[model samples]
Target: GAGAETALLLGLPIATLALIVKNIYNGMFIPLLCHKADAYAEVGDTRGIERMHLISGIGLSLTLGIIVTVSYLAGVNMVKGFLDAIPEFIKHGLSVATGIIPALGFAMLARLLINKKVAPYFFLGFVLMAYLKIPVTGIAILGAIVAVVMVNMPKFAASQPAPAQGASHDDEDDF
Candidate 1:
Protein backbone atom coordinates (compact mmCIF):
# COMPACT_ATOMS: atom_id res chain seq x y z
CA GLY A 1 0.00 0.00 0.00
CA ALA A 2 2.83 2.40 0.81
CA GLY A 3 4.56 1.71 -2.48
CA ALA A 4 1.32 2.06 -4.39
CA GLU A 5 0.58 5.33 -2.66
CA THR A 6 4.09 6.62 -3.34
CA ALA A 7 3.85 5.54 -6.99
CA LEU A 8 0.49 7.19 -7.50
CA LEU A 9 1.67 10.35 -5.80
CA LEU A 10 5.00 10.59 -7.63
CA GLY A 11 4.03 8.99 -10.94
CA LEU A 12 2.28 12.03 -12.41
CA PRO A 13 5.14 14.47 -12.97
CA ILE A 14 7.73 11.72 -13.25
CA ALA A 15 5.75 10.06 -16.00
CA THR A 16 5.44 13.36 -17.81
CA LEU A 17 9.17 13.97 -17.56
CA ALA A 18 9.85 10.42 -18.74
CA LEU A 19 7.67 10.93 -21.80
CA ILE A 20 9.54 14.11 -22.64
CA VAL A 21 12.93 12.43 -22.22
CA LYS A 22 11.86 9.42 -24.27
CA ASN A 23 10.62 11.62 -27.07
CA ILE A 24 13.82 13.61 -27.17
CA TYR A 25 15.91 10.44 -27.08
CA ASN A 26 13.92 8.86 -29.90
CA GLY A 27 13.43 11.89 -32.09
CA MET A 28 16.70 13.78 -31.78
CA PHE A 29 19.48 12.19 -29.77
CA ILE A 30 19.11 8.79 -31.44
CA PRO A 31 19.50 10.21 -34.92
CA LEU A 32 22.44 12.37 -33.86
CA LEU A 33 24.13 9.39 -32.25
CA CYS A 34 23.51 7.22 -35.30
CA HIS A 35 24.86 9.87 -37.62
CA LYS A 36 27.94 10.28 -35.48
CA ALA A 37 28.46 6.53 -35.43
CA ASP A 38 28.06 6.32 -39.19
CA ALA A 39 30.56 9.14 -39.63
CA TYR A 40 33.06 7.31 -37.46
CA ALA A 41 32.47 4.10 -39.40
CA GLU A 42 32.91 5.93 -42.72
CA VAL A 43 36.22 7.36 -41.53
CA GLY A 44 37.42 3.93 -40.28
CA ASP A 45 37.64 5.35 -36.78
CA THR A 46 37.31 2.31 -34.54
CA ARG A 47 38.33 4.20 -31.41
CA GLY A 48 35.61 6.80 -32.09
CA ILE A 49 32.96 4.16 -31.68
CA GLU A 50 34.31 3.05 -28.32
CA ARG A 51 34.47 6.67 -27.19
CA MET A 52 30.93 7.36 -28.48
CA HIS A 53 29.62 4.31 -26.65
CA LEU A 54 31.26 5.36 -23.43
CA ILE A 55 29.97 8.91 -23.83
CA SER A 56 26.46 7.76 -24.68
CA GLY A 57 26.19 5.39 -21.75
CA ILE A 58 27.77 7.73 -19.23
CA GLY A 59 25.92 10.75 -20.57
CA LEU A 60 22.52 9.11 -20.24
CA SER A 61 23.28 7.59 -16.87
CA LEU A 62 24.65 10.84 -15.46
CA THR A 63 21.76 12.82 -16.89
CA LEU A 64 19.21 10.49 -15.36
CA GLY A 65 21.00 10.34 -12.05
CA ILE A 66 21.23 14.10 -11.82
CA ILE A 67 17.62 14.52 -12.81
CA VAL A 68 16.53 11.97 -10.25
CA THR A 69 18.57 13.52 -7.50
CA VAL A 70 17.50 17.06 -8.35
CA SER A 71 13.86 16.08 -8.85
CA TYR A 72 13.84 14.22 -5.55
CA LEU A 73 15.36 17.20 -3.78
CA ALA A 74 12.89 19.58 -5.40
CA GLY A 75 9.98 17.25 -4.70
CA VAL A 76 10.90 17.23 -1.01
CA ASN A 77 9.42 20.70 -0.54
CA MET A 78 9.63 22.96 -3.59
CA VAL A 79 7.40 20.99 -5.97
CA LYS A 80 4.70 20.66 -3.35
CA GLY A 81 4.76 24.38 -2.77
CA PHE A 82 4.74 24.98 -6.52
CA LEU A 83 1.74 22.69 -6.88
CA ASP A 84 -0.03 24.54 -4.12
CA ALA A 85 0.49 27.79 -6.02
CA ILE A 86 -1.43 26.48 -9.03
CA PRO A 87 -5.05 27.59 -9.56
CA GLU A 88 -7.86 25.43 -8.20
CA PHE A 89 -9.08 24.42 -11.68
CA ILE A 90 -5.53 23.51 -12.73
CA LYS A 91 -5.16 21.40 -9.60
CA HIS A 92 -8.45 19.66 -10.38
CA GLY A 93 -7.25 19.02 -13.92
CA LEU A 94 -3.99 17.63 -12.58
CA SER A 95 -5.92 15.28 -10.32
CA VAL A 96 -7.96 14.07 -13.30
CA ALA A 97 -4.82 13.58 -15.40
CA THR A 98 -3.09 11.71 -12.59
CA GLY A 99 -6.02 9.30 -12.28
CA ILE A 100 -6.32 8.80 -16.04
CA ILE A 101 -2.60 8.27 -16.68
CA PRO A 102 -2.37 5.15 -14.50
CA ALA A 103 -5.53 3.77 -16.10
CA LEU A 104 -4.02 4.45 -19.53
CA GLY A 105 -0.84 2.66 -18.47
CA PHE A 106 -2.93 -0.27 -17.24
CA ALA A 107 -4.84 -0.30 -20.51
CA MET A 108 -1.60 -0.48 -22.47
CA LEU A 109 -0.38 -3.30 -20.24
CA ALA A 110 -3.69 -5.14 -20.54
CA ARG A 111 -3.33 -5.04 -24.32
CA LEU A 112 0.15 -6.53 -24.08
CA LEU A 113 -0.37 -8.90 -21.14
CA ILE A 114 -3.85 -10.34 -21.77
CA ASN A 115 -2.69 -12.29 -24.79
CA LYS A 116 -2.97 -16.10 -25.14
CA LYS A 117 0.55 -17.02 -24.06
CA VAL A 118 0.49 -14.75 -21.00
CA ALA A 119 -3.17 -15.04 -19.97
CA PRO A 120 -2.80 -18.40 -18.28
CA TYR A 121 0.02 -17.16 -16.05
CA PHE A 122 -1.99 -14.07 -15.20
CA PHE A 123 -4.99 -16.18 -14.36
CA LEU A 124 -2.89 -18.58 -12.36
CA GLY A 125 -1.31 -15.78 -10.38
CA PHE A 126 -4.69 -14.18 -9.87
CA VAL A 127 -6.26 -17.36 -8.66
CA LEU A 128 -3.33 -18.09 -6.42
CA MET A 129 -3.51 -14.67 -4.85
CA ALA A 130 -7.26 -14.22 -4.79
CA TYR A 131 -8.88 -17.62 -4.47
CA LEU A 132 -6.26 -19.86 -2.87
CA LYS A 133 -4.99 -17.30 -0.36
CA ILE A 134 -1.38 -17.76 -1.42
CA PRO A 135 1.14 -15.39 0.10
CA VAL A 136 3.03 -12.99 -2.15
CA THR A 137 6.24 -14.96 -1.50
CA GLY A 138 4.61 -18.21 -2.59
CA ILE A 139 3.12 -16.67 -5.71
CA ALA A 140 6.43 -15.00 -6.60
CA ILE A 141 8.29 -18.29 -6.18
CA LEU A 142 5.74 -20.08 -8.34
CA GLY A 143 5.90 -17.36 -10.98
CA ALA A 144 9.67 -17.56 -11.11
CA ILE A 145 9.53 -21.34 -11.42
CA VAL A 146 6.98 -21.07 -14.20
CA ALA A 147 9.05 -18.43 -15.98
CA VAL A 148 12.16 -20.60 -15.83
CA VAL A 149 10.27 -23.62 -17.06
CA MET A 150 8.72 -21.68 -19.90
CA VAL A 151 12.00 -20.19 -21.07
CA ASN A 152 14.44 -23.08 -20.67
CA MET A 153 12.25 -26.15 -21.01
CA PRO A 154 9.35 -26.04 -23.40
CA LYS A 155 9.19 -29.80 -22.95
CA PHE A 156 7.64 -29.32 -19.50
CA ALA A 157 4.63 -27.70 -21.08
CA ALA A 158 4.32 -30.31 -23.85
CA SER A 159 4.82 -33.15 -21.39
CA GLN A 160 2.47 -31.95 -18.66
CA PRO A 161 -0.10 -29.24 -18.67
CA ALA A 162 -0.55 -27.30 -15.47
CA PRO A 163 -4.05 -28.31 -14.47
CA ALA A 164 -6.95 -26.16 -15.66
CA GLN A 165 -7.18 -22.73 -14.07
CA GLY A 166 -4.06 -23.67 -12.08
CA ALA A 167 -6.35 -25.60 -9.77
CA SER A 168 -5.11 -29.07 -9.04
CA HIS A 169 -5.35 -31.60 -6.24
CA ASP A 170 -1.64 -31.46 -5.58
CA ASP A 171 -1.40 -27.66 -5.31
CA GLU A 172 -4.09 -27.44 -2.61
CA ASP A 173 -1.59 -27.16 0.18
CA ASP A 174 0.91 -24.99 -1.67
CA PHE A 175 -0.32 -21.88 0.10
Candidate 2:
Protein backbone atom coordinates (compact mmCIF):
# COMPACT_ATOMS: atom_id res chain seq x y z
CA GLY A 1 0.00 0.00 0.00
CA ALA A 2 2.68 2.48 1.06
CA GLY A 3 4.96 1.49 -1.85
CA ALA A 4 2.16 1.93 -4.36
CA GLU A 5 1.20 5.34 -2.94
CA THR A 6 4.83 6.47 -2.88
CA ALA A 7 5.36 5.14 -6.43
CA LEU A 8 2.68 7.57 -7.60
CA LEU A 9 4.25 10.47 -5.73
CA LEU A 10 7.83 9.67 -6.79
CA GLY A 11 7.38 8.11 -10.24
CA LEU A 12 10.96 6.88 -9.97
CA PRO A 13 12.47 3.55 -10.97
CA ILE A 14 13.51 3.10 -7.32
CA ALA A 15 9.87 3.37 -6.29
CA THR A 16 8.94 0.63 -8.75
CA LEU A 17 11.80 -1.48 -7.38
CA ALA A 18 10.53 -0.79 -3.86
CA LEU A 19 7.01 -1.84 -4.83
CA ILE A 20 8.32 -5.08 -6.28
CA VAL A 21 10.48 -5.76 -3.23
CA LYS A 22 7.59 -5.11 -0.84
CA ASN A 23 5.22 -7.29 -2.87
CA ILE A 24 7.71 -10.13 -2.83
CA TYR A 25 8.82 -9.85 0.80
CA ASN A 26 5.57 -8.81 2.46
CA GLY A 27 2.94 -10.39 0.21
CA MET A 28 4.68 -13.63 -0.71
CA PHE A 29 7.54 -14.50 1.63
CA ILE A 30 5.96 -13.38 4.90
CA PRO A 31 2.89 -15.54 4.37
CA LEU A 32 4.85 -18.41 2.86
CA LEU A 33 7.88 -18.67 5.21
CA CYS A 34 6.82 -16.84 8.36
CA HIS A 35 3.48 -18.62 8.75
CA LYS A 36 5.18 -21.99 8.45
CA ALA A 37 7.68 -20.89 11.07
CA ASP A 38 4.76 -19.98 13.35
CA ALA A 39 3.32 -23.46 12.81
CA TYR A 40 6.70 -25.01 13.63
CA ALA A 41 6.91 -22.99 16.86
CA GLU A 42 3.41 -24.06 17.89
CA VAL A 43 4.30 -27.69 17.35
CA GLY A 44 7.52 -27.42 19.46
CA ASP A 45 9.58 -28.48 16.47
CA THR A 46 12.89 -26.71 17.14
CA ARG A 47 14.54 -28.34 14.13
CA GLY A 48 11.69 -27.36 11.90
CA ILE A 49 11.83 -23.80 13.22
CA GLU A 50 15.59 -23.62 12.62
CA ARG A 51 15.20 -24.96 9.10
CA MET A 52 12.47 -22.43 8.39
CA HIS A 53 14.64 -19.59 9.61
CA LEU A 54 17.55 -20.71 7.43
CA ILE A 55 15.29 -21.11 4.45
CA SER A 56 13.70 -17.68 5.07
CA GLY A 57 17.12 -15.99 5.15
CA ILE A 58 18.33 -17.74 2.02
CA GLY A 59 15.05 -17.16 0.19
CA LEU A 60 15.06 -13.44 1.06
CA SER A 61 18.69 -13.06 -0.01
CA LEU A 62 18.07 -14.79 -3.31
CA THR A 63 14.89 -12.75 -3.88
CA LEU A 64 16.73 -9.48 -3.28
CA GLY A 65 19.65 -10.49 -5.51
CA ILE A 66 17.36 -11.60 -8.32
CA ILE A 67 15.16 -8.49 -8.08
CA VAL A 68 18.13 -6.12 -8.06
CA THR A 69 19.73 -7.93 -11.00
CA VAL A 70 16.52 -7.98 -13.03
CA SER A 71 15.77 -4.37 -12.26
CA TYR A 72 19.29 -3.33 -13.24
CA LEU A 73 19.10 -5.35 -16.43
CA ALA A 74 15.58 -4.16 -17.26
CA GLY A 75 16.69 -0.49 -17.05
CA VAL A 76 14.66 2.72 -16.51
CA ASN A 77 12.62 2.60 -19.71
CA MET A 78 10.92 -0.59 -18.65
CA VAL A 79 9.97 0.81 -15.26
CA LYS A 80 8.83 4.03 -16.85
CA GLY A 81 6.77 2.10 -19.39
CA PHE A 82 5.22 0.11 -16.57
CA LEU A 83 4.35 3.34 -14.75
CA ASP A 84 2.98 4.86 -17.94
CA ALA A 85 0.66 1.91 -18.48
CA ILE A 86 -1.25 2.79 -15.29
CA PRO A 87 -4.35 4.86 -16.08
CA GLU A 88 -4.23 8.61 -15.46
CA PHE A 89 -7.49 8.47 -13.53
CA ILE A 90 -6.06 5.78 -11.24
CA LYS A 91 -2.95 7.90 -10.68
CA HIS A 92 -5.07 10.94 -9.80
CA GLY A 93 -7.24 8.84 -7.51
CA LEU A 94 -4.21 7.46 -5.65
CA SER A 95 -2.81 10.98 -5.28
CA VAL A 96 -6.08 12.24 -3.88
CA ALA A 97 -6.37 9.27 -1.51
CA THR A 98 -2.80 9.80 -0.33
CA GLY A 99 -3.61 13.41 0.57
CA ILE A 100 -6.87 12.52 2.31
CA ILE A 101 -5.54 9.58 4.36
CA PRO A 102 -3.39 11.74 6.65
CA ALA A 103 -6.24 14.21 7.12
CA LEU A 104 -8.58 11.42 8.13
CA GLY A 105 -5.96 10.11 10.57
CA PHE A 106 -5.64 13.58 12.11
CA ALA A 107 -9.42 13.91 12.38
CA MET A 108 -9.66 10.55 14.15
CA LEU A 109 -6.91 11.59 16.57
CA ALA A 110 -8.58 14.97 17.21
CA ARG A 111 -11.90 13.29 17.97
CA LEU A 112 -10.19 11.37 20.78
CA LEU A 113 -8.05 14.26 22.07
CA ILE A 114 -10.11 17.43 21.61
CA ASN A 115 -12.31 18.67 24.47
CA LYS A 116 -13.64 22.00 25.84
CA LYS A 117 -10.27 22.91 27.36
CA VAL A 118 -8.18 21.81 24.38
CA ALA A 119 -10.56 23.13 21.71
CA PRO A 120 -9.33 26.72 22.00
CA TYR A 121 -5.75 25.76 21.21
CA PHE A 122 -7.00 23.62 18.35
CA PHE A 123 -8.90 26.59 16.90
CA LEU A 124 -5.91 28.85 17.55
CA GLY A 125 -3.68 26.60 15.43
CA PHE A 126 -6.31 26.48 12.70
CA VAL A 127 -6.64 30.27 12.74
CA LEU A 128 -2.87 30.75 12.66
CA MET A 129 -2.57 28.57 9.58
CA ALA A 130 -5.80 29.69 7.86
CA TYR A 131 -5.97 33.43 8.57
CA LEU A 132 -2.41 34.43 9.50
CA LYS A 133 -0.97 32.07 6.85
CA ILE A 134 1.68 30.91 9.28
CA PRO A 135 3.38 27.76 8.17
CA VAL A 136 2.82 24.51 10.12
CA THR A 137 6.39 24.50 11.43
CA GLY A 138 5.87 27.98 12.88
CA ILE A 139 2.57 26.92 14.44
CA ALA A 140 4.18 23.78 15.88
CA ILE A 141 6.93 25.85 17.49
CA LEU A 142 4.39 28.32 18.85
CA GLY A 143 2.34 25.45 20.23
CA ALA A 144 5.40 24.03 21.95
CA ILE A 145 6.15 27.40 23.53
CA VAL A 146 2.55 27.75 24.73
CA ALA A 147 2.63 24.24 26.18
CA VAL A 148 5.86 24.91 28.08
CA VAL A 149 4.59 28.20 29.47
CA MET A 150 1.25 26.70 30.49
CA VAL A 151 2.91 23.74 32.19
CA ASN A 152 5.31 25.98 34.15
CA MET A 153 2.85 28.75 35.07
CA PRO A 154 1.42 26.93 38.06
CA LYS A 155 4.89 26.05 39.35
CA PHE A 156 5.96 29.66 39.07
CA ALA A 157 2.78 30.86 40.83
CA ALA A 158 3.24 28.29 43.66
CA SER A 159 6.89 29.17 44.22
CA GLN A 160 5.98 32.33 46.19
CA PRO A 161 3.78 31.65 49.20
CA ALA A 162 1.05 34.13 50.00
CA PRO A 163 1.53 36.33 53.07
CA ALA A 164 0.49 34.66 56.37
CA GLN A 165 -3.20 35.16 57.21
CA GLY A 166 -3.84 38.27 59.32
CA ALA A 167 -0.20 39.29 59.17
CA SER A 168 0.40 43.01 59.66
CA HIS A 169 1.44 44.91 56.56
CA ASP A 170 4.53 46.18 58.39
CA ASP A 171 5.57 42.58 59.46
CA GLU A 172 5.28 41.33 55.90
CA ASP A 173 7.09 44.37 54.58
CA ASP A 174 9.98 43.87 57.05
CA PHE A 175 11.09 40.70 55.17
Candidate 3:
Protein backbone atom coordinates (compact mmCIF):
# COMPACT_ATOMS: atom_id res chain seq x y z
CA GLY A 1 0.00 0.00 0.00
CA ALA A 2 2.84 2.34 0.87
CA GLY A 3 4.69 1.38 -2.30
CA ALA A 4 1.57 1.93 -4.40
CA GLU A 5 1.00 5.32 -2.81
CA THR A 6 4.61 6.30 -3.44
CA ALA A 7 4.34 5.10 -7.04
CA LEU A 8 1.14 7.08 -7.58
CA LEU A 9 2.69 10.19 -6.04
CA LEU A 10 5.76 9.90 -8.20
CA GLY A 11 3.83 9.19 -11.36
CA LEU A 12 2.39 12.70 -11.74
CA PRO A 13 5.75 14.45 -11.94
CA ILE A 14 7.27 11.78 -14.15
CA ALA A 15 4.27 11.91 -16.47
CA THR A 16 4.36 15.70 -16.45
CA LEU A 17 8.03 15.66 -17.42
CA ALA A 18 7.22 13.18 -20.18
CA LEU A 19 4.40 15.39 -21.48
CA ILE A 20 6.63 18.46 -21.48
CA VAL A 21 9.36 16.58 -23.35
CA LYS A 22 6.92 15.15 -25.88
CA ASN A 23 5.09 18.43 -26.56
CA ILE A 24 8.24 20.56 -26.82
CA TYR A 25 9.82 18.14 -29.24
CA ASN A 26 6.72 17.44 -31.30
CA GLY A 27 4.95 20.81 -31.20
CA MET A 28 7.84 23.24 -31.20
CA PHE A 29 11.13 21.66 -32.30
CA ILE A 30 9.75 19.49 -35.10
CA PRO A 31 7.76 22.40 -36.53
CA LEU A 32 10.91 24.53 -36.64
CA LEU A 33 12.48 21.84 -38.81
CA CYS A 34 9.34 21.64 -40.93
CA HIS A 35 9.42 25.44 -41.34
CA LYS A 36 13.00 25.14 -42.57
CA ALA A 37 11.83 22.64 -45.14
CA ASP A 38 9.07 25.06 -46.19
CA ALA A 39 11.69 27.82 -46.60
CA TYR A 40 13.47 25.52 -49.03
CA ALA A 41 10.20 25.04 -50.88
CA GLU A 42 9.92 28.82 -51.11
CA VAL A 43 13.08 28.98 -53.26
CA GLY A 44 12.17 25.89 -55.24
CA ASP A 45 15.04 24.02 -53.57
CA THR A 46 13.67 20.48 -53.21
CA ARG A 47 17.03 19.30 -51.87
CA GLY A 48 16.45 21.34 -48.72
CA ILE A 49 13.35 19.28 -47.94
CA GLU A 50 15.38 16.09 -48.23
CA ARG A 51 18.15 17.61 -46.10
CA MET A 52 15.66 18.56 -43.36
CA HIS A 53 14.28 15.01 -43.40
CA LEU A 54 17.81 13.62 -43.08
CA ILE A 55 18.62 16.01 -40.24
CA SER A 56 15.39 15.14 -38.41
CA GLY A 57 16.05 11.41 -38.80
CA ILE A 58 19.58 11.81 -37.47
CA GLY A 59 18.40 13.98 -34.60
CA LEU A 60 15.64 11.54 -33.60
CA SER A 61 18.09 8.62 -33.69
CA LEU A 62 20.68 10.50 -31.60
CA THR A 63 18.07 11.54 -29.02
CA LEU A 64 16.78 7.98 -28.66
CA GLY A 65 20.33 6.64 -28.36
CA ILE A 66 21.15 9.12 -25.59
CA ILE A 67 17.90 8.32 -23.76
CA VAL A 68 18.62 4.58 -23.90
CA THR A 69 22.16 5.10 -22.69
CA VAL A 70 21.11 7.30 -19.79
CA SER A 71 18.24 4.97 -18.82
CA TYR A 72 20.58 1.99 -18.78
CA LEU A 73 23.06 3.95 -16.66
CA ALA A 74 20.34 5.01 -14.23
CA GLY A 75 18.82 1.50 -14.02
CA VAL A 76 22.14 -0.14 -13.07
CA ASN A 77 23.22 2.73 -10.77
CA MET A 78 26.19 3.34 -13.01
CA VAL A 79 25.61 7.07 -13.03
CA LYS A 80 26.68 7.23 -9.37
CA GLY A 81 25.95 10.63 -7.77
CA PHE A 82 23.57 11.67 -10.54
CA LEU A 83 21.45 8.64 -9.80
CA ASP A 84 21.60 9.24 -6.04
CA ALA A 85 20.88 12.97 -6.37
CA ILE A 86 17.48 12.46 -8.09
CA PRO A 87 15.55 11.10 -5.10
CA GLU A 88 17.44 13.29 -2.63
CA PHE A 89 15.52 16.31 -4.00
CA ILE A 90 12.56 14.78 -5.86
CA LYS A 91 10.08 15.85 -3.21
CA HIS A 92 11.32 19.43 -3.34
CA GLY A 93 12.13 19.67 -7.05
CA LEU A 94 9.52 17.47 -8.71
CA SER A 95 6.63 18.66 -6.57
CA VAL A 96 7.26 22.16 -7.83
CA ALA A 97 7.81 20.88 -11.33
CA THR A 98 4.56 18.92 -11.19
CA GLY A 99 2.62 22.15 -11.03
CA ILE A 100 4.88 24.09 -13.36
CA ILE A 101 5.07 21.48 -16.10
CA PRO A 102 1.36 21.52 -16.92
CA ALA A 103 1.34 25.32 -16.93
CA LEU A 104 4.21 25.29 -19.38
CA GLY A 105 2.57 22.54 -21.40
CA PHE A 106 -0.66 24.52 -21.68
CA ALA A 107 1.30 27.65 -22.61
CA MET A 108 2.97 25.71 -25.40
CA LEU A 109 -0.33 24.20 -26.52
CA ALA A 110 -2.13 27.54 -26.48
CA ARG A 111 0.29 28.71 -29.12
CA LEU A 112 -0.04 25.51 -31.16
CA LEU A 113 -3.71 24.59 -30.75
CA ILE A 114 -5.69 27.74 -29.90
CA ASN A 115 -5.73 28.88 -33.48
CA LYS A 116 -8.89 29.34 -35.55
CA LYS A 117 -8.23 26.49 -37.98
CA VAL A 118 -7.07 23.94 -35.38
CA ALA A 119 -9.20 24.76 -32.32
CA PRO A 120 -12.32 23.13 -33.67
CA TYR A 121 -10.55 19.85 -34.23
CA PHE A 122 -9.05 20.10 -30.75
CA PHE A 123 -12.44 20.61 -29.12
CA LEU A 124 -13.96 17.86 -31.23
CA GLY A 125 -11.39 15.37 -29.98
CA PHE A 126 -11.76 16.63 -26.43
CA VAL A 127 -15.52 16.14 -26.62
CA LEU A 128 -15.05 12.68 -28.06
CA MET A 129 -12.88 11.75 -25.09
CA ALA A 130 -14.68 13.65 -22.33
CA TYR A 131 -18.32 13.16 -23.18
CA LEU A 132 -18.67 10.45 -25.81
CA LYS A 133 -16.02 8.24 -24.15
CA ILE A 134 -14.47 7.14 -27.41
CA PRO A 135 -11.18 5.36 -26.80
CA VAL A 136 -8.08 6.99 -28.27
CA THR A 137 -7.45 3.96 -30.48
CA GLY A 138 -10.93 4.25 -31.92
CA ILE A 139 -10.52 7.99 -32.44
CA ALA A 140 -7.19 7.48 -34.19
CA ILE A 141 -8.63 4.82 -36.49
CA LEU A 142 -11.66 7.00 -37.21
CA GLY A 143 -9.38 9.99 -37.90
CA ALA A 144 -7.29 7.94 -40.30
CA ILE A 145 -10.38 6.74 -42.14
CA VAL A 146 -11.66 10.32 -42.41
CA ALA A 147 -8.25 11.50 -43.60
CA VAL A 148 -8.12 8.85 -46.31
CA VAL A 149 -11.61 9.68 -47.49
CA MET A 150 -10.94 13.43 -47.50
CA VAL A 151 -7.71 13.04 -49.42
CA ASN A 152 -9.22 10.78 -52.07
CA MET A 153 -12.43 12.81 -52.46
CA PRO A 154 -12.78 14.47 -55.86
CA LYS A 155 -11.90 18.15 -56.45
CA PHE A 156 -14.23 18.73 -59.34
CA ALA A 157 -15.24 22.22 -58.16
CA ALA A 158 -11.63 23.38 -57.77
CA SER A 159 -10.59 21.71 -61.04
CA GLN A 160 -13.46 23.10 -63.08
CA PRO A 161 -12.77 25.92 -65.57
CA ALA A 162 -14.06 29.39 -64.75
CA PRO A 163 -17.08 30.38 -66.82
CA ALA A 164 -16.30 32.54 -69.86
CA GLN A 165 -16.70 36.32 -69.33
CA GLY A 166 -20.05 36.31 -71.13
CA ALA A 167 -21.16 32.85 -69.90
CA SER A 168 -22.56 33.84 -66.50
CA HIS A 169 -22.14 36.81 -64.14
CA ASP A 170 -25.19 35.45 -62.26
CA ASP A 171 -23.29 33.40 -59.57
CA GLU A 172 -20.68 36.18 -59.06
CA ASP A 173 -23.47 38.78 -58.61
CA ASP A 174 -25.13 36.67 -55.87
CA PHE A 175 -21.90 36.60 -53.91
Residue 29 in model 3: lDDT:
75
Alpha-carbon runs more than 4 Å astray in model 3 = 1-91, 151-156, 159-175
TM-score of each: 0.43, 0.55, 0.39
| Model 1 TM-score on a 0 to 1 scale | 0.43
- Computed on alpha carbons, the lDDT of every model, listed in order, comes to 0.72, 0.78, 0.68
Q: Tell me how far the alpha carbon of residue 95 in candidate 3 is from the true structure, in angstroms, after superposition.
A: 4.1
- Locate the minimum summed-lDDT window of 10 residues in model 1: 14-23
Please give, for residues 37-96, the per-residue lDDT of candidate 1 as tens digits. 889999999898777777777767676666566766677355455545657895576568
lDDT (Cα, 0-100) at 2 in candidate 3: 52
lDDT of 2 by residue, 40-145 (tens): 8998999988998898778777876776577556776776777678788967766686689799999999999999999999999999999999999999999999
Candidate 1 ranges beyond 4 A from true positions: 1-81, 154-175
Better of 1 and 3 by lDDT: 1
Among these predictions, the greatest lDDT belongs to: 2
Candidate 2: worst-modelled 10 consecutive residues by lDDT? 5-14
Q: In candidate 1, list every pair of residues with a backbone clash.
A: none
lDDT rank order: 2, 1, 3
